[model samples]
Target: MPPRTPAAGSRLMQIGEAAERIGLSIRTIRHYEEAGLIVPSARSEGGFRLYTEPDLERLAVVKRMKPLGFTLDEMRDLLAVLDALATADDEERRTLLDRLGMFHAAAATRVAALRDQLAVAEEFAGTLRARLDHHGSCTT
Candidate 1:
């Protein structure tokens, strides 16, 4: 594994605080662990998950992937590809670079799909607003 970045502070946070910091529910954070997406930085003496800044950054990546609707396997693949790219050399570096390019293309596709969905959602919202306005004027 590539070395994790040095955390700004050595202080470790429990799972709840980590979840709050990442804007995800505790259960969701646990689910990410279960999915092998992110591992806690450490375990306390009582066995509670302890998270550091690097761990939070990993969770943040998963959060961004969640919004883009990336599958668990896709997330795992991307993480592995990124890790490899960081330390790859020569031939391996070229292959990892190609993999990164594929991920970029896939992300662009997902973003375009999201844009289409958003446009449809906006039109629906506009329809609802018009109906609400009509009903409000009638009710008055």
Candidate 2:
């Protein structure tokens, strides 16, 4: 059987393109799919996974969360909160918002920690460069 293409004017793309556009490896995307973090928007007749813009957006969220040290379960929970916010009733919306706020706070803390680590690393590199300069200047 021939491979099926996306419908006319559709913005769907195959997994490779989706991975590239989302700045994640194809393997990572597949792993996310296996972890229930995302689902492809469609599949070609040949069984190729296809993704739409929203699918890419979902992957993007996971990508951003990774560097912040969020575990798969945290990522999945955050994604679920985001998904529920769209059409949630007022009471549910309030609960979801609270959860979202907690995630935001956690991310902010993690980012600050990363910044501190980066500063320390940069300082260490600077010290090494200073030592090299001093050694190179010595007359022997």
Candidate 3:
């Protein structure tokens, strides 16, 4: 049987499409769901998971956090902060903004570390290329 469409006026998609659109694998999306980082926005009549644009946005956030080496707990906490900010009052918004700032700082530090590692890797590759060039010249 063909896949059932979402209700009229909604743009829900199944797990496979959600994963592709979010640049994640289905298993990764399911893992995030299990970890409470995100949940599908709805389900089809046949019980397949359906996700909305907001759901995919959440997954994109998690995807970004993963490469920065964030733990599941960290991801959950960050997601909570982001969610609360949308509806928070002035005082609550201040606290949530502070939390969000911390996450941003942590991500920046991780990105800088990765750049340093990449620099070292590139230098090593260059060394190897130089050695190969030296050997090739000696053989000629």
Predictions in order: lDDT = 0.86, 0.90, 0.88
Task: Determine the backbone clash count of candidate 2.
Answer: 0
Q: Find the 10 residues in a row with the least total lDDT in model 1.
A: 1-10
Q: Give the per-residue lDDT digits (tens) of candidate 2, residues 46-134.
A: 99998888788888999999999999999999999998999899999999999999999999999999999999999999999999999
Residue by residue across 1-140, what tens digits does model 1's lDDT show? 32244456677989999999999999999998888888887778999988888788888888998888889999888888876777888999999889889988989999999999999999999999999999999988
Identify the runs in model 3 with alpha carbons over 4 angstroms from their true place.
Answer: 1-8
Q: Write the per-residue lDDT of candidate 3 for residues 1-140, one digit (tens) a residue.
A: 12234456779889999999888999988888888888787788999999888788888999999989999999999988988899999999999999999999999999999999999999999999999999999999
User: Highest lDDT: which candidate?
Assistant: 2
Model 1, position 33, has a per-residue lDDT of 87
Clashing pairs in 2: none
TM-score of each: 0.84, 0.91, 0.91
Tell me the spans in candidate 1 whose CA falls farther than 4 Å from its real position.
1-9, 138-140
lDDT of 1 at 75: 89
Task: State how far residue 15 of model 2 sits from its true place (Å).
Answer: 0.5
- Model 2 weakest lDDT span, ten residues long: 1-10
